[model samples]
Target: MTMKKLGFAGVMIVALVGLSLATQAQVKKGKTRPLTTKQMMAGLVKPQCAGLGEALKAAPSDDKAWEELATKAALLNESGYSLMDDGRCPDGVWASACKNLQTASAAVLAKIEAKDYAGAQAEFKGVTASCGECHKAHKK
Candidate 1:
């Protein structure tokens, strides 16, 4: 069957396999575990994404709102970096997705810093698209 036909489950399976390989590679490198990728995704990426998504729904009308969105975007960017660290990136597709995540989140943060609401909104779409792409290859 084609990957498209396999859908989400197939993508998830691919992600899991990549994760497994990455873990093995890390073990070979004699790295010690701090947190699992799943844990990081659940604890960090999920919440930050949620916050960013909610914040992006409206243009930040004030400094406080902008700060909040900035914080979320920054955290999301960090999550992307974390995903690629410690031999956690097993393959090219995973690496590309993670890089896209970082790039998009950084763009969002820049827009927030510049107080460009429209630009921020456009860039935020890139952020979400990166997440979707990664999930399409990894999330169950």
Candidate 2:
């Protein structure tokens, strides 16, 4: 009777472990599916761009503020690359816009690193313009 009970307990543990592994596998597969364009824009691009815009409103007075601006620019650059990743880019226009965004954000980051507020502001305009161009082509 003890042997039978142990056998049953062992089988239950194995079954539970298998179930947990299967659940985790499913979740990993789901994560591989890319975010929708809207999701990417709202989750990353928009917020990052907004942060850059707000930061550009005034020159950084200290190292912390400058670092914040640089962080936003880098995030915006990454978001631009993400826009084109995972087969999300639909056409040349989308590609062009994404490239423009990357270039602009890089420029903004460079200016921020140099502590050049005016240059950063100038480059930031290109970032916003790239967004507008893409929206004009695709947004409803």
lDDT (C-alpha, whole model) for all candidates: 0.81, 0.82
How far off is model 1, as Cα RMSD? Answer: 10.0
lDDT for each residue of candidate 1 in 1-140, tens digit (9 for 90 to 100): 88899899998999999978766664233245678766787888889888888877887889998998899999999988878777766567778888999999999999999999889888888878887886786665
lDDT of 1: 0.81
Task: Kindly report which residue stretches of model 2 are placed more than 4 angstroms away from their true locations once superposed.
Answer: 1-32
TM-score per candidate: 0.75, 0.75
Indicate the worst ten consecutive residues by lDDT in candidate 2: 23-32
Q: Please write out the lDDT profile of model 2 over residues 31-89, one tens digit for every residue.
A: 25656667667878899899889878988999999999999999999988877665556
